[model samples]
Target: MTVKQLSSSGQFNILCMPEPEREIDGVYIGDLLSWVMGKAEADNVWITIMSNINVIAVASLSDVSCVLLAEDVTLESDVLNTAKEKGINILSTPLSAYEAALKVSGMI
Candidate 1:
């Protein structure tokens, strides 16, 4: 599924969607930035509760299609703006990481 399609489905809230047409090829769930940076594949829908500025950096470095902020986790204005400026797609959901993964699994 594409980032725009996923956000339009109402499963997640769009925080920063500079690349809304980006396609989601897979899902990666984790909180540790280092681990995620290594494990998250390009075009994967990364699911995590981390809302820090580094999350944006890791997302860019990992080349993930989008960052799924689980459990309603939110980013600060500066981080959100950075995500927008960096052309990173960041989404949020009220569901836990596992639950959100399940939902993404069904969708993809």
Candidate 2:
């Protein structure tokens, strides 16, 4: 299913949708930028506890479709703005990464 649908209709919260036009395989954990770059696929919904601007950068570099902040965290305006400029999707939810992963995994 689409990331937007998963967040809006599924069981998770999605914050931003810069590139909502894209579809991902499973909900990929958006943590350890380098690790994700090497491990995540192009269609994975990134679920990370990080809210740094670097997260957006890595998302772009990794060719990811969207990012989900899996926690009640606040992303800096600059980070969100960068994501918009980069055309990367961003989201946030009260659930932790692990929890979000579980919910997303069940979907696919």
Candidate 3:
């Protein structure tokens, strides 16, 4: 499923979607920045409770289609700006990481 389609499913709130049409190939759930950077695949939806500037950098380096912020975690203003500038798509949900992953799994 595409990022846009997933966002429209009402499971998440759109934070910044610079590439909503980007396709989701899979899901990666992690909070460790370095581990996620090394393991997350291109076009995968990275699910995490992390909401920092480094998260943006890792997402860029990992080339994930989007960052799914679980537990309604949100990036700071500066980090959100950086994400927009880098064309990183982001979404947030009230569910925990595992719950969010289940939702995404069912979708894509």
Q: Whose TM-score is higher: candidate 1's or candidate 2's?
A: 1
- Top lDDT: which candidate number? 3
**lDDT by residue for model 2 (1-108), tens:** 776777675455555677776877876775688899899887887788888888987889878767877777878888888888998887777888898778777776
Worst 10 residues of 3 by lDDT: 70-79
Per-candidate local distance difference test: 0.93, 0.77, 0.94
> Taking the tens digit of each residue's C-alpha lDDT, what string does model 1 give over 16-100?
8999899998999999999998888999999998888999999998999999999999889999999999999999999999999
Kindly report which residue stretches of model 2 are placed more than 4 angstroms away from their true locations once superposed: none
In model 1, state the lDDT of residue 61: 89
In model 2, pairs of residues that clash are 15-91, 15-92, 16-90, 24-43, 25-43, 30-47
Q: What lDDT tens digits, residue by residue, belong to model 3 across residues 1-108? A: 999999999989999999989999899999999899888899999999988789988999899999999998878999999999999999999999999999999998
Residue 38, candidate 3: Cα error in Å is 1.6
